[model samples]
Target: MLTFVAAVSTGFPAQAQNDRATTTVDYTVRVNDTLYDLASYYLTDPGCWTVLKKLNRVADPKHLQPNSTLRIPLALLKQSLLAARAIAVSGSVERTLGQGPFLPLNFDAALTEGDHVRTGPNSFATIQLSDGSHVTLHANTTILIKHLRATVLNGIVDRQFELNQGEVETKVTPLKPQDRYNIISPSVIAGVRGTEFRVVYGDGAGAGNTAVEVLEGKVAAQGPNAPPVLVPQQFGVISDSAGNVGAPIQMLPAPSLAEPGQVQKGLQIVFEIAAMPEARAYRATIATDAGFLHIVNEIRAESPRALFDDMPSGSYFVRLSAIDRNGIEGLSQIYSFRRARPSEASAAATRTANFEFRWTEDAHAGAGAGAQQTYRFVLATNSQLHDPMLDQTALAGTRLVLSDLKPGKYFWSVAAAVSPNNGESHEKPASIRSFTVGQ
Candidate 1:
């Protein structure tokens, strides 16, 4: 049976109300329906069949199978030709698209002009524009996608975004001569072309300070009444809340990776950076995305490097920035990295009086020749390894031999340690093996 929600002149009734912030409505196919009919009713413009076809990738609008589903994109149905898409999201990120109420934003979600995006604490989102530019919103930030439009005939794209609060990182692609990308903060406007930059519009105590850091290419920052200031690579400017624009200052230099080419081992992915003068501390963020939509681990290290050990094995990116005494974070390049654990380990079968355990070695071990590995061996009678056990620590080498052991059934395992130091003590346990022994 086909279900229809009060067929009105605007086509079918919205089947499901998306509670979260989303721009598109889901519609189920019914009898005596054509793409043109659906578009005419819901979109109020039957001539938008081409846009609907492109949006839904429908080969034949006339042949929409019965009970088939379609997504009625409210953005395309609206007057705007371009929309911002959330390509990646993590944590509590939400958006308001078109007239739709705020809803939980997800990956690949599209937002129309005048849409708003807000991120909660520890939340992050990355949006991609039609021109291949990207904007990443950090935690506790709110931004409005004020305008996004493109003309197919002229191949011109014009975008405008407003950062209401907090920070955002932008990577703008090269645009056509007439194309434009503009970001407006509370006190200033930043215009860019084929550039990478970060903008911070403060809140609370930091209010009235709209800071712009140009990482690559250049950006033009201007106040409401002041002239534009050309900020080039590795430079920044701030517009105070009082409507006063400040002079450009040199941005903090990139901190060099201590061992950029080194493979990460053990549970902890350790990072070291060269010390920079006047650097009070270093902030490191690790993410799966190069743009760092959602950072998995973020830490502030007083030392030259940072260590992250709480994540699983996969390719990741590390971004390191310097923090001056005033808590201003400097610009840093994103570094690709991988966290790999030592190979799985196994123990010898059935042992009589003495038994030994061995495990694999990591190629990038230790300070030099090989990784410095310390092994911990455990021998227990039960698989649970509750009590009847001999726990040995600081066993140097791949194998450990235990003598004068009378056992019926014993379970043993080996663990590796990066060093003898007392920093973040977590046992990297290996696979356990059971053995039978006869006295």
Candidate 2:
């Protein structure tokens, strides 16, 4: 094996100390593998052979035993640069490539290292890394892509992001040895191998405060003033701008929605979560897809109710989360629902004629006029309709008339059920009406 003469006589550089402080990867020595060859192939600088010799305590730099392992500090390793693709971008998201001007972060925007991203108020953006990991940026946030690199020979990756401000939610893919996934905030650094977590840096209202919440796997949280601490699942940590990181605290549990309707058939869509013990506010988001890859709307509510009035009729998923006093969001729960809206129907009873009870609706109530429309009617002596005196289904007409009646108050309701040509069932919300029948 050829030897690096300069590496043998030279002293290690001061950078070696910084490199030693970083994570390390193990490389098994192969036939004809020397410190010189290993440094040339796997390291940024081939002349760092002497540093490798000192790190591995090698007796012979020119001849390395086959199958022996050598530890290489990650800081000294060489890696190829990569990019992240913007899969879903909405509202007022913008991006900057290097020193270039900021452009709108449209669909499938490719961002590389040194790029920066900022989201405006009431906006959102989601980017996917080369390894299938995802990072979602909420409104009013700024972040810099510090590093996005990979080493092919050792199959290790290094992905790091510097959070300037605001919040980011991440779903990191499982990591291997020497694989680093870190999000550095102003006050703290959160490092994880594989997890679903959230890191918020000076979330608008809570300036100078950095919070990390782990939903899955574990994270190593480090601050300037404290040693690294392990934060397990359903846990979080808070770090202040003063560089002090607090102990991990148990995160809030998922909140249950207050018995949401199985199928919403109204002009508006609404969700009300059951009040949680320590919740100060609630956040609800809606998406067309189950994975939430494309979010359509999001709202924050001080009260339990969250209303969304402009969504069209379709199947969707709703994710709910609670915020604590410190403005930290908790674990979330997703629920499925169907919205069938634009229901318009009216009911009335004529006293003169044969006690006619009639109702009318627009010809195209969700399903167009060409679709087959059916009506279902229920009548009872009680308001609750516990025991119906008249129960009718699959009737063709909108009006229902009863000939002779006793002197008593009665309650009834009717709904238009449209069977669309596309085979989707559409139900116009029913309206109950009351009238007195005289003998």
Residue pairs that clash (backbone atoms under 3 angstroms), model 2: none
lDDT of 2 by residue, 125-171 (tens): 88788655788888788899988988856757778788888888887
Candidate 2 ranges with C-alpha deviation above 4 Å:
1-25, 34-37, 49-65, 68-73, 262-268, 339-439
Each candidate structure's TM-score, on Cα atoms with residue i matched to residue i, is 0.55, 0.67
| lDDT of candidate model 2 versus the reference | 0.70
Clash count of each predicted structure: 8, 0
Q: Please write out the lDDT profile of model 1 over residues 1-439, one tens digit for every residue.
A: 0110111111111322231114455678888778888777656467887777887788888878789878765444433367567767878999886668889998778777889999987678888775446788888889988768764323356677888998888877656554557777756566665677887888421566777777777765544445556677787776677656667678687686766655565557788889998888887877664335446566678889787755655556677888665545787755655455644111112222233333433222232345455667777888877784688887665455455555255676666554434655555435555543333
lDDT for position 159 in model 1? 78
